[model samples]
Target chain A: MRRPMPVLAAGQVHEVHGEGDDRAAGLAFALGLGTANRQGAVLVVRGALRQGLGLYGEGLARLGIDPARLLLVEARDAAALLRAGLEGARCPGLALVLLESEGPLKGYDLTASRRFVLAAERTQTPLVLLRHAARPQPSAAHTRWQVASAPSLPLEAPPGAQVRPPGLPMIAVEALRWRGGPAGQTWHLQWDEQHGGFRDTTGSLGGTPNRNENARTAPSGAVLPMAALRTG
Target chain B: MAVERDAARHGLAPGMTLADARARCPDLATLPHDPAADAALLTHLAKAMHALTPSVTPDPPDGLLLDISGCAHFFGSEAKMVAKATEITGLSTIHALAGNPAAARALARHGTPAQRRAEDVAALPVSALDLGEAATTALRRAGLKRLGDLVTRPAPTLAARFGEGLVLRLRQVMGDVAAPLAPQPVQAPIRAEARFAEPIARTDDVLEVAEDLLRQVAAQMEQRRLGGRHFALTLHRSDGARRRLLVETGQPTRDPPLVVRLLRERIDSLADPIDPGFGFDAITLSVKRADPLDARQTGLDQSEETQDSLQALIDRLGVRLGQDAVLRLAPADRHMPEAAQVSLPAAELNSSVSFHLPAMPRPLLLFDPPQGIEVIAGVPDGPPLRLRWRGAVHEVIHAEGPERIAPEWWRQRGGHMGEGATRTTRDYYRIEDARGRRLWVFRRGLYDGMENAPSWYVHGLFP
Candidate 1:
C-alpha cells in the first residue's frame, strides 16, 4: 500500500538532528525546507565554533537558494544563538528561521523552546532547530526528524567505464516524533536542483536488485525494519 | 609679557622684555606662556561663537572674525550679536564690523573709537595696513603718517615707493578687494536641546526628554524634506560628565518612535550602562548625517510593507548585535573557492551585481584553508582509492574525474618559475566515501618527476 508524504506545518517549531559525520546533511535538509517555502528572506543563526567551515554562496545557489535573500548571523555562543533565533522568529517578514549549534545546547531548554514556539506562532513563521552531535530531548516541537546521508544514484558513464560518478545529493529522513500525526516513517529523498525540492526515491532504490546487497549493509537501509515495527 | 589693566596703568605692555617689564613695575607677576593653552582657548571660543553665526573664523593667538552681514538680524543688530557672543564666551572682547574681513580685523586691532564709529578708513594711521615696520617707517618718514595721505596718491606711485605689498594691503584694508576667510564647516541646524530646572535621574524621564527632542528634530527634518541615517543623543550631567548614545539605520528615516526604539536597544546592550550619575541637567539630539528622503506613503502594498518590515528587522538586529554581526552574502567575481563570495554588513551592502552560478557543482561549505589528508591512490596521478582524514580511514565508493585547474599566473609572483612562487596547479575530484559522505578533495601539484610527491587536501563538504 502507498502512503502519502508527511509535511511539516508552518507557524511551529521543528527539530532536526544529525550525529557526528552527518551534520552537513542536517543543514542541507533545513535549507531545503527554507527554499521550498519561498516566502521572504531566510535568517540562519549559528554559533561561531563547530561550524567546520562556513557556508559558501555558490554552493547555496547550486542548491537553488538565492544567496542574496540569505542573512547569516554568527553568535559567540549558544545563548547568543538563542537570542538571535528568538529575534528572527519574531519577525513576520521572514519565511523561515534556521538555528544551528553543536554539542548539548544548555540554553535551549524547555523554556527557550516554548518561547521560540510562542514567537513563531504569533508571527506565523516556521522555525527549525538544527542540532549537531546531540541526542534528542523532550521539547514543544511540532516534529522531530533524524537525518543521515545516503548514497546518490550513479551518473551515466561511457561504455565499459570502470567507475560511475555520484549524481544529485540524497538523504534519509526519519521522523522520530510527530505532535498530531503518526510518526516513525522513513523516506529516502533526492534533491532535485532544477525544481528546487525533494523527490521521493524510496521505490526506485528497491528496483535495483544488483545493488540490494550493498544497500542492506548501509546505515540508512538498516533503519527500515525498526521504523516498520514502530509504525505497525 | 602682556599685562592686565593695573599693570598697563603702571606703564607695562606686551612685546616688552620680561626684565624691562619687571624693572618698570617692581611688583609685577608673570607666568610662562603656553601656546597650546592659548590655541585651545581660541578653539573653544570659536565653537562658542558658532551659536551666533555659522561663519566664525578663528584668527589664532587671540582673535575671532565674525561675518555678521546677514546673521545680525537674528540678534536684532550687530551690537547685540557681539554682546551675545561676549556673554557666551564670558570674555571681554574687542569686536568690529566692516565691509570685508581685512577691514574688520584691522578695525578691531588698531582703529580708535572715533575712527571706528565714523567708519573712516582713510583717517586711520598707516600702521593699519600691516605692511611691516620698514614700510610704515618709510611712510612716516616721508610725512605720510595717516592713511589719508596714501589714499590721495596714485596707485603706481604708491607701489613704486612702498612696494606692491603695501599697495595690496592698503587696498584690502580699504575694502577695495575681498579677503578670504576660512570658516569652519557647519552642519545643518537639525538639532533640538532642552535644559531642566531640576536634574532628572530616572531613565523614564530621560527617555521622555529624548522623545520630546526627537519630535522637534523630526519636524525640522520634515520641513527640509530630509531624513537622518545617524542620530546621536547626548546627556549632560550636573557634574560635567556626558553620556552619549548613537543609533544608525539602514535607510534614511524620520520616524521618532523608531529612533527611540533603537536607542532603547542600544542602552540595553551597553556593556557599561549609563549611570546617570548626579542626574542629567540637559539633553541634546542632533542628526550627524542626512539624506534626501521624500515623504513616503504607508500601507501601499503587501510587497512594500514586507520590505519595510524586513528593513526594520535588519536595523533592530544591527542595533542589538554589532553592525558587523548581521551580514549578507554577496558574490565576488573570482574563480578561487575562498574568494568566490564575501560576507558584508547588511547596512553597508548595496551590491547590484548579479551572482553567476558556477557551471560545475560546488560544495555547500568550504574550509578557509583546506585540511590536508593522507591518500593512497590507485596510480601516481590517478584518483584516490582510500583517504585518511581527521584520524579516520574512508574507503572511496565512487570517484569522479580529475578536473585540472591551472593557477592564475597573473596573480602569482615570478610567473610560475621562480623560487619565490608559491601557488601550483590543482586537480579536483568529487569523491563519495563508504558512508555516503561526499567530499571535494584536490591534489596539489603534479606527479611529474621534477619535485617531491604531490599531496592531497579536502577542500569542502557536500550535502
Candidate 2:
C-alpha cells in the first residue's frame, strides 16, 4: 500500500506554476526549519555570489542552530551543477543542500525544472538556486527571486561607505515571486568574514523575514564582532 | 738388612717393614701408589653404566645401583645380565648385585672382587656382611667368624645384640622389605645415522650426504607420526673432522626433498678443507625438536601453496651473507619503535601477534623512533606551519586536524618530555606537503611555560 504523503504545516503548499513577475521583488518569510535553529537540508545554485548566499548563511547563523548542513558543489556549468546537486540525495545526514556555479545559466529547460521541483519536495530538501538573470528559469521553482545587493559597510565603516575592503562583497535581493509574502522584500546585509556569513539589521520588510526574535539579540556594533561564526 | 729383605722373597715374616723388604729384595723396585685415580676410573664406569639407565647414580664415585627388573629382559636372563656385568667389568673393577645394598657392598669389597652369588656370599665371614669393626670383634670374641654360625641364631638374641639395622639388612637380603631404585625414564631419541662408505671430501659431496641423511630422518619421523622443525646435519670427514650445519624450517615438515634441499644450500657453502682420507665412516643427521604435523586437511580444490618459495628465497640470501642478516618482523610487547619488533627465526615465530593496547593509532612509517624535528608554529594548540625534519624544511600545505592521543599512563612514567616523545602527550596532525607528501607528526607535551616543551618529531609517513 502506498503511504499517504505527509501534509505540510496547515497545507501551506504554494503549487506555484511559473515566474509571473519581478516588479516588487516578491518577498516571502519562511518560518520553517531554518538551517541554524534545527537540523535540515537546503539547496543553492553554484556561483550564486555573495548576495543570496551571504543572507542565507547569516540567517542560518542567527538561528542558534543545533547543527547546520550545506551540500556544496563546485561545478563547471549549469548541467554539471545539477549533476553534482543530485549527488546530495545519497547523504542520509543531509541537512541543507546548496548549489553554486559562475557559468551562464540563461537557457535551462522548464520541462526538466518541473521534475526538479517534485524531487525537492519529495526529498524534503528545499532547493535554492542562484542563476544568471538572462537564463530561462524552469517553471518549477516554487519561488523566484533576482538576488542583488551590497555589504552594509566595510569592517571599519558603517553602511553606505566607499572605504570597504576590496575583497568584501555586497548583496541586494528582491523576490520576483513569493507564495506567502509581498513581492518586494529587500534587506541590506554585510558579510562578516569572522562569522563566515552575512548579517542584515535592516529588517526583512520586503522579502523573507526568516529570523525569529532571538536572532535580533546578537550584538552588531560599529566593528563587526567576528564572534558567533564558524565554517568547515 | 738388604740380605734379609732379599731372603724375604723366599718367605717373609708377618711383622715386616720397607727397609727389611728392601734388604730382602734390593733389586725390587716400588712405585708410589694412587688411590684417587682408581676411584676416578670407577666413577667413569658409573657414567658408562648410564647405558643401562639415566638413573645410574654413583654411590660416591665408587658404587653403582641398577634397578635391573626391566633391564634383565634386554639381556635375556638374570645369568646373562650378570655375564654382561662381568663383560663390562673385565679387568678394571669389582662388580656385584644382590637383593640388599649391604650384601652388594660387602660382595663388592671381597669375594674375588668381580662376581659372586647369594649362597657363596652367605659363606663369607661375618665381616663380609658390612658389620662395624667393633661388632666383628665382638662376634670373633664369641667365636662367630663365619656367617654360617649366625644363620640359625635365635632372632630375639641377635636383635638384643646387634640393634636393628643388621637384622633389617639380613632380612632385606632375604627379600623381606622391598628396596626400590626409581629408574629415570630414558627417551629413546629419534635419531638418523648415515654411515658413509666413502667419506665426503669435496663440499658438493656433503650435499649428497645430506640428501641420504634426510631420507633416514624423514622415515624416523614418519614412523612416529612426528615432524621435525629443527635438524642438525653433520659431515664426518674421514680425517676425523666434523662440520655441522643447522637448518630450521617454519612449519614442522617431513618432506625429505625439501629438507635435503635446505640443508644442501647451507652445507655446500662451507669452506671445509675436508679430506676423504679413508672416506667418512659415518654421517649423522639428528632432529633436535619434533612435533606432530597436524596439517590442515585439504579440500577437493585445495593445494598446499607451501611457503616454500619464500623460505627458499630466505635460505638463498642467508647462505650468501649470514643467518643474522635475514630478519622477520615479529610482534613484540612494546611501544618503543626499536622494541616494537622481535627478529626471530622465521620458522620459529608465533603466527598470532598479541599486544596489550591503549589502542593509540600507530603510524604506518615508524623510524627507529625519530630524531626530534624542530618545529615553528602556534604552540600549545595550533598545528605547525614550518617543520624542519631530517634537515629539510617542509611547509605544511594543508592540515586536516589535530587528533590528540595521550600517552599510555598505566606503565611507569617517564621524565617530562614537554608534550610527548617518550612519555608525553601527543597532538598528532595529518599534515600534507605542498608536494603532496603526507606525514603523521606529533607535538610533544603541553607548550605551557610550566616546564620544558621544546621537542617535536615526525613519527611516520602516510601515503
Q: Judging by DockQ against the true structure, name the best candidate.
A: 1
**Candidate 1 chain B: minimum summed lDDT over ten consecutive residues — where?**
B414-423
Model 1 C-alpha lDDT per residue in residues B1-463, reported as the tens digit of each score? 4568788789888899988997988787899989999899999888888888889899978999988878989999878887898899886677777889998888888889877776677778888888889888999999998888998899999898889998888888888877889997775678999999999998888888888999999999999899999999999999999999999999899988889888988898898999998899999999988899999877656888877777877888899888898899888766577787888998888653446787887888888789999999988877899999999999987888788877666676667674423336888999888777888999988876866778899988888
* Residue A58 in model 2: lDDT: 20
Which residue pairs in model 1 clash with each other?
none
lDDT of 1 by residue, A80-198 (tens): 78988998998887878998888898778788999999999998888999998888998889999888887888787646546778789888777788877757766776787666667
Per-residue lDDT value at B271 in model 1: 89
- For every candidate, what is the interface RMSD in angstroms? 2.0, 23.0
Instruction: Indicate the TM-score of model 2.
Output: 0.41
User: Against the hidden reference, what TM-scores do the models get?
Assistant: 0.73, 0.41
What ranges in model 1 sit over 4 Å off?
A158-161, A207-232, B1-53, B56-185, B416-423
Candidate 1 accuracy as lDDT: 0.81
Worst 10 residues of 2 chain B by lDDT: B356-365
lDDT of 2 by residue, B221-292 (tens): 888788887788776766777767777765677877777766665555456644556566677888988989
